[model samples]
Target chain A: MSDRIRIVVLLFPAMLIIVVLFFGGLVVGLMRSFNYMPVIGLTEPNLQAYWSVFTDQEFFLSFLLTFHIAFTSTVISSVLAIGAALLLRRRFVGRALVNFLFQLNLTVPHLVGAIGILYLFSQSGSFARLAAEWGMIAGPADFPELIFDPYAIGIIIQYVWKEIPFIGLIVLANMQSIGEDYESVARSLGATRWQAFRYVLLPLLLPGVLSASVMVFAFTFGAYEIPALLGANFPAALPVLAYRKYTDVDLAARPEAMAMAIVIALLSAVMIVIYLRYSRRRIRD
Target chain B: MTHVSIQSLTKTYPGSSEPSLDNLSLEIASGELAALLGPSGCGKTTTMKMIAGLLEPTSGDVTFDGRSVLRDKPEHRGVVMVFQNYLLFPYMSVAENVGFGLKMRKVNKVEIDNRVNDMLALVKLPGLGKRKPSELSGGQQQRVALARALIVQPKVLLLDEPLSNLDAHLRFEMRDLIRSLQQEMGITTLFVTHDQEEAVVLADKVALILDGRMKQYDSPDVFYKRPVDKATARFFGGQNFLNGNATNGQFKTSFGVLDLPIDCRRGTGTLTFRPENICVTGKTTETNTINAQLVEKIYLGTQTRLKLAVGTEFIHAVVNPAEVENLEQGQRVNIAIPPESLWVLTS
Candidate 1:
């Protein structure tokens, strides 16, 4: 056999596996959402599952709640990560140690950090115990319920802790690529330090910021572990709601879970594509 | 227009054993284009950055037109710099990039437009306003950088190897462009370049530096003809160096003895001469000529370079293309060193 043919033959299995596992599953789920799955004994095509997904009150609330958490956490993390990356741009004593500590999140699972956050912020946790010991509060009962709050503050905090370092790593890589010449040139061109950063450095960093924010938002939207562990049960996020629907005793609820998964995937893909187009236009202009 | 004066400026980088610039003092008059010509690591860029206030001097001060700008910021000093890479903002359009400094100064809109248009025309990039830097070629980007700096009408213009990034042909064209622009604007310009030929072509006066020290500061002609030290002589295209005794306007060497002018009466010293100053002739004689065999010859388009073995040393001499008819490899020839062209450097 020729080398090109041999190479194609060697790649066939992996390609087939990816198509079967990813695209094939996606097509099957999408067809099932339209109620045209012969394997499940629903032959006539219909929009009943999608209509249920759209009209369900809890579905809309879960979608809005996911957006709120992801957008808020992504924006907050991007700003903090940019600040941290700028601070770490210059060499100082213990810089390596500080950088390692910031990147420690990538090694530790998010669920582990969420557990630690719960312990620290819970009503009967270390913070409450410390408050009682310091006489700032009378007892654990006086300590406010920070974890499992309806607003998902604990989840947002945990997400920021995990995501900011990831964004910082990206921002720092881009900043290092920019080097010191641009800043020095701006300074020589009669720009102050802050003005130089605002004019020259920030514009150059927009691409990295855009892509990193997209990744952070997508990860936060689909994140199941931290929100499942720390989020309030009253109004669950889409991921949590989907998990509940899948585990429920009713076999009919599984379609709605699959439909929710498809919606989340589509939303993330659209957001990424739109962000990429916007950033490309900005860079071109 | 502004006159720039430096008083013992010194810059010592952190953890470095030696200062990059050590107690250097120089002055550039208003509307004068001065070239800081040096080898790499000679503190040329450091000096330019210090003058632009991008770097703080370890000690001493810089003054512009009788005003000490040591404490003032770079914007307040009214100094602008054109970097080696041009550093044109990649995201902004050419017009926006050129007008950035003016906008920062809050110039009126109509006046900013007129000035930006005039600058673009001056750089010969009139209609390229809507294009980004990546869309422009290297030379065009350099022109935009030049326009960006000059549009503000800065008091002093600092250029750090602005033409080095260009190709040889573009470098020549941009050199001419920079010279004409500087002449038209009459702004005090300080250009830093390691290319000796570039320094001679674009500068009214050249400052030669080596190892963070100034070697010579003079007109290009004088710097080439009369160098004070061996380093300066070797830097300005003078190739041949001979160590011999000089006494009473005469010197004796292994090649032959040649008569020197009355001005160079040092007892013993080194003599330097350019390759172009040495001539080879078919006619051989005992006086004022050294009999040497041609080892190799290289044909450059306009001139043929001949390498001759004189004593134990090889000396390069340039001859006219037509003169090659009388010269061949392994031929014995008499090489003549004119007395006036010999430069004697003592110590």
Candidate 2:
């Protein structure tokens, strides 16, 4: 056989799984999103599901809430991650233990983390009792509402907590690969320590930081479990709301739910494209 | 121009018993280019960092023209260093990289642009300012680094093996460029290098370092002709060492008695001479000539290396190929060593 054909044959197994499973599901979802599900006797494809989704006031609210969660969580976590990486890159006592503990949660499932946040941060949870005993609050019921609050503070906290180390690990590796030479050069060129980091090291680290952050943004944008577990009932996170529609007794809501899912995927895809373009320009420059 | 002085600089890294840089001292005259010449791990880089104020010395001071700079930070010390890899900021343009120091000093935009262009012209990299550092070749990037450091008009310029990352051809070109620029600008430069030839060719004075200590600091010719010890002489390519005891002006070795210079130290010592100083076919001198059988002949392109035996000890000499063309391995030849070429090392 030719080399090209042999390589394709070898890659066929992995290609089969991705093309059949991932793109296949995406095509099916796109089909239903246009109201073309033949199982429901709707052979005609149209934009009615999208029209209904865009017409709903609650859809826009859920979108803003989801955007807020993703953007705020990503920004906060990215800043904290950069800070942590800078500190961790230096040599110190107990650094190995600290780095190990910082990355330990990456193995834990997101659902488990949401549950932990719920157990600790809910109004009647352990923190509430502790606060009541300490006279910070009169009773458990008087504790501030974090979970199931209108602002989705609990959800944002969970994401920021989990994603800090996720992005921190990437930024740390990037910092190490960039090394201290550039900063040393900057210092010798009459730059103060802060200026060295700000001008030279920060610009060098931006491409890696942006790529890692885009991944976090996309994951948090489309994820459902964390929002569903600790979200308000009135205007839920977009994914949670879409899932609710997917499981509703009304069969017509299924197409709108698929439309929302496709919308979420499109937004995340847009972010990834921006990231790729930026990194490409960086490499070329 | 600034007179650079390093007084008893020492550094012992944490958890290490041996000092990385021992009590080292140097006095570089204003506008002089001095090289810290040593093998790798010989504390050359350590001493460079101490002078640049990038490293904290365990106990000592670095001064510029009689002012101690030990309390100053690296930026405040008015010293800049060009590193081995020419670490140009990848995100910046050539002009920006060169003007970075002026920008840090808050120089105005128009002035920075003018000076950046002038510096670029000085480095022979004019009109390449719009390009990024990554787009330039290795030699060009190195020129950009030199321009960047020189644009700051630093008191002392420290180069830590600056040409080490380049190819052989580029290394030679950069060596010429560095020497010309140092002479042109009259900057007090302390260059660190492991190559003896490079140190000799570029430095006004070369300081030979060995095992974390300064062995000898003198002019380039002195390092080759009058090294302080066996190691320094060996480092400078001295191949013939005769162990003997010198009393008054006469040296007694296993081979025979030879005349020593007037300043030769008395008692037990080793006498060293360069290989090229041994004349294979020449008029015999009365006291320093020896008759030995040629044991081996290795044909080098420009010179032939002949191993000779005087008694049980072997001596290697490099002579013109034409002089040794008729000589055979077992044939005996009389070789003369100039008395002035011999340097006695007491330690």
User: Across residues B1-347, which tens digit of lDDT does each residue of candidate 1 receive?
Assistant: 88888788889987787999877778888999999999888899999888877788999789998788988887777888899889998888999889888877778989888888989999999999999899999999999999999988888998999889999999988999999999999999999999999999999888888888888888898786789888998888777788888877778666767788667757678887778877776565533567888999999899989889988878888878787766779988888877877778885
- In candidate 1, list every pair of residues with a backbone clash: none
Kindly report the docking quality category of candidate 1: medium
Candidate 2 stretches with Cα past 4 Å from truth are A1-6, A272-285, B285-287
Residue A183 in model 1: shift from native, Å? 2.4
Candidate 2 chain A: 10-residue stretch with minimal lDDT = A276-285
- RMSD values, in order shown: 2.8, 2.2
What CAPRI-style quality would you assign to candidate 2? high
Encode model 2's per-residue lDDT on B1-347: one tens digit a residue. Answer: 99998999899997799998889999999999999999999898878777777878999989898999988988998899998888899878999999999998989999999999999999999999999998999999999999999999998999989888889999889899998999889899999999999899889999998999999999999987889888898899998888999887888899898888887778998988889988885456555899999999999989999999999888989999999999999999999887788878874
Clashes of each: 0, 0
TM-score of chain B of 1: 0.94
Deviating ranges (above 4 Å) for candidate 1: A36-42, A273-285, B252-257, B280-296, B308-315, B329-335
